[model samples]
Target: MTLELNQLSDQVQALSATAAERLASLERQRPAAEARLRAIGLADDELQGKVRAALRYRWAGAIPAAEPVDAAFPCPPHPARANVLAADGSQVYPDRHGVALYYLINVGSIAFRHGSGEAPRVASRPAVFYEDADLYEEEGRQKPVEKIDAERDRRELGELARLAAANADAPAVALLDNGLLLYFSLQAQDRAEIKRELAPYLAHLSALRDSGAAVAGIVDRPRAAGVARLLHLHTLPMEALKDHADLFQQDADFRHLTDGALFADRLQPGERSALFENGSPANLDHFQPAGHSVFFFYLNPGPAGRHALLRVEVPEWVAHDPARLDLVHAALVEQCRATGGFPYVLMRAHELAVVTVAERRELEQMVVAALVRRGLSLSVSHKAQGKAWTGAGRRRYP
Candidate 1:
């Protein structure tokens, strides 16, 4: 209890006031924003130029959205019978001071056949990296957490690909718990590193593209302001825009609004926004080259009054094909309806794939026991030993 409730009362009050004010502001600006979006309605030649200029000038705050977008979409009715396959991953990061120094990526997957009213098939697969080559970077350093995360993402896609292959006869939809695009940090790290990391993942995406499973990534409570950024760019004087720093430095109209908030009122239950491409370099360079450029749409999955904003990302092939896109849209809305907010398969996958603290500790003990039985003395850093002895709380009630 570092913070006392009594001490935080005034701050909490201030925060509530700010939140109410912002909510009111959002309500006020929503009309204008909708009109602005309607005005732009997929005409993005000028917006594309703005995006390119922002990239060339290294615009710090520039967000990438598809140049060609259909900013309006009506709700597609749920299909009678469709297979929903979702994959989620969890990881155990390498610990230098633990009994073993290795990382683990566990992928959990599920295939739910709606309309059949049957039980879903669920499974989990865990890959442990014990070898030096698996554990280390190209430069001989222990692989960082970001690299490990990307590996987990790759495994998630691989799991989707495997499931999609098995259920080819049925209309299948592949789901993920995150964005389809490779994270920006991985892209900025190194060209070779990004290429190496994304090669297999991109391949899986390409395979999934042709595999008949409509792959989509579902993001709950999304805060992506891509459309807001484009709207901001539209209001700017194109001729005077020289420095990218102006993007961040200027007083922008759509400062803190998210795509969700902007589209919430318009999208009723089960409805989705226009499909917009994400023009990040990672998408253009890696995924697009392989014919799987990532695109997205905002969806409202909750009831009429309580609109839950869910962002759905799909690859180029899925976006282009109406039948595939309908599968993704209807499948997601149905899944959300069953789960109340998010996809049921994704929730189950997380449960199956998660590495609990007890499991991790038990594995470490097994490692120590094996070493001891082999007559090899086990040694841990004194700092680690000291912390282990004192890490537990002295008073559970307190």
Candidate 2:
């Protein structure tokens, strides 16, 4: 057998014990985290001063907006007539051993018009890249997976922009199945690369904003510790913060605590936490200047006892405008109500975008037929051929 389950019994027992201990630790820390969050005053000039000072050291935390840090705003009334547009993207990465050196990205989108009772609009846009420039970087190296993923993300946002522009007459909320900030900056080689990657994304954000649509990036079961970091920073004295260089490191008080866990209890069913500006360097450096600084809040699109935590990220413009912000919050809650906890539109978009293995094989077969018609000899590598032949087998234990 490639892997024997019997061999993992002892390790599995130890892992279970470790998880139990971590849960105990999480329970012990939960109350203190909640208390600290509830105690912070939004207008505390001293606290804001401290956070601003800590920002200089690249502290990854949450900055308070107009709402109180402990505020739990109930879901606003959903607009009687509104548009909820969502887009999701999937990709098939290039396989070197396959018939062709090409990758494909397909984006699926849905435009659900509330109160209209009309059938929702759906679309799936697919693009295949085979050109040398599309496959290779400036130095002729094959493009990394991150670059390709960034391209998919760009297309997803661009699709949302197009959808939003077309539905500008009504109150609309455009949703993405990710964070608003593009993570490509972390892998960027230089400032130029960062700018190049962000230009198109920023332009799309502008387009969405100009189209009078509120845009948001929704993350389910988020692992972000931005709020926890803020609570940890609050515990430190100003004197210690001044002396400590790496002030953002998690201490014993709140190690491994996430914002999702922190707000799970505080936010009741169909409620959202106070908005906080993200203090990441990318937000402060590039996006903020372009007037798209990202702000996020925790939400529980719930049914009474169960907790379904989500982190909803919006730009500065949406956060400041009352109507747009309300539309985003209410539209999400209404959308989630249709599918238990998560938004129905996002689920449908993902289902439409996903590429199955059978579909991939059919695509390869079509490529082979095209080559054969042109009298060109094209075949998979020897290893790929052998693997295909032996792919199906039953596991055996030794």
Candidate 3:
């Protein structure tokens, strides 16, 4: 019995010692992990503070009220025509070597009538453009893929802008997929080059706007959306307060909370409706400063329907941040070191907006289909009823 007791005591002491060692090791690991994060370009106090402030302003429920502006032309004259345009770009990952090949897809359409009642007809085929991967050697180191993506983005946007401007007609409304104007405010090593590339497009857009036409550029994935989502999630009750804690424990449960049933049961009957009612679709506009990316969202609502635009900004910080790139490099190095080969490195853009052009089209089609589904005949057509010409000894008749 004495021998058994001694053995038991020894085992307990050994277990305690192991636990202590593990705790100390974890303590040591925490700082190292934090340092690694910092090395990967985690913002210090000032940058983080700025990010927070930007977020706060975005979700403060303080949307600015626009002062009404006088119209350029009074009514009771000729009816004005409006046009809608949207453009988006996608990148292709060519191989496992982290090479980025880019393509731009631009769509523009014209609407002849006003209000949400009339459907717009397609005016032009979606233009597809591509840019080849460019390579540059710096101190025997090739330029990073992120820089290439930024350069391509600038080039593609410039082309899209020019195309839209050329197609604009009298008293028309132009919608840009990303922002009201190209962001000349990017901080890249090739900043001047980017500006020079975009100058013509910028001038054209400015000229169009200056002419009495209402030209608006929108960035649908504005960084404000992420901040708004964060604020929204914070407003929900804690899991402990819920009757079924298990159901609300995970983020997926909260994210797929579209039905309003889970949250409804916890609140008063009327309060349940209020919780899910005022919500907008998820906003994706998150700022990746180290990556030098900005997402923006813009919306223009006329009599017919709302025109939405999405813009993504890729800046120089994506390539310049050594710490940011190091994490990627380390991951590749580790895989290569372990497996005797590394897998392809491909980075994807995080979605910044759920309401894409596809989604908008789907919604619009649904509405039109619903009318047909209810057995109503729908007809759409365009006819030139009249023609008027100004100047140059021409007959004004159609």
lDDT of 3: 0.32
TM-score of each: 0.89, 0.96, 0.31
- By TM-score, the best candidate is 2
Tens digit of per-residue lDDT, candidate 1, span 1-398: 33469988999999999999998888877878878877776656786677777656544332334433435465688778888998999998998987668888899899887777889889999888989988887789997788888889989999999999987867999999999986633356577768877888888987887788899998898887767766776667767467555654433455577777888777778878777777556666677787887788888876555658889999889888999998888887777776777888888888988889999888788789988999978677888999877776444473
Local error of candidate 2 at residue 177 (angstroms): 0.3
lDDT value, residue 78 of candidate 1: 73
Residue by residue across 1-398, what tens digits does model 3's lDDT show?
11457668978999999978765554544443323323423234443333344333333211111111110111112223333333334433222221122222323333323223556433333322222324443454444545544444444444444544654553333333443323433333364554554555445444543443343333332332232232233333443224333222333312322111121122221110110001111111211322212222111111112222122221223123333222222222221232232111111011221235575446445545877788876543222112112222444466
Candidate 2 colliding pairs, count: 0
What TM-score would you give candidate 3 relative to the actual structure? 0.31
> Where is model 2 more than 4 Å wrong at Cα?
394-398
Task: Please identify which of the two predictions, 1 or 2, would achieve the higher TM-score against the true structure.
Answer: 2
lDDT of 2 by residue, 1-398 (tens): 34679999999999999999988898889998888887895638777877998998888789888888989999999878999999999999999999889999999999998888899999999999999988999898999888889999999999999999888768999999999988786566587888888999999999999999999999999999988888878777888888766485666888799998888888988899999999998888889999999999999987666669889999999999989999999998888887877888899889889989998888888888988999989999999998877777665678
Off by over 4 Å in 3: 1-80, 93-133, 137-168, 181-184, 187-201, 210-212, 225-398
Ranking by lDDT: 2, 1, 3
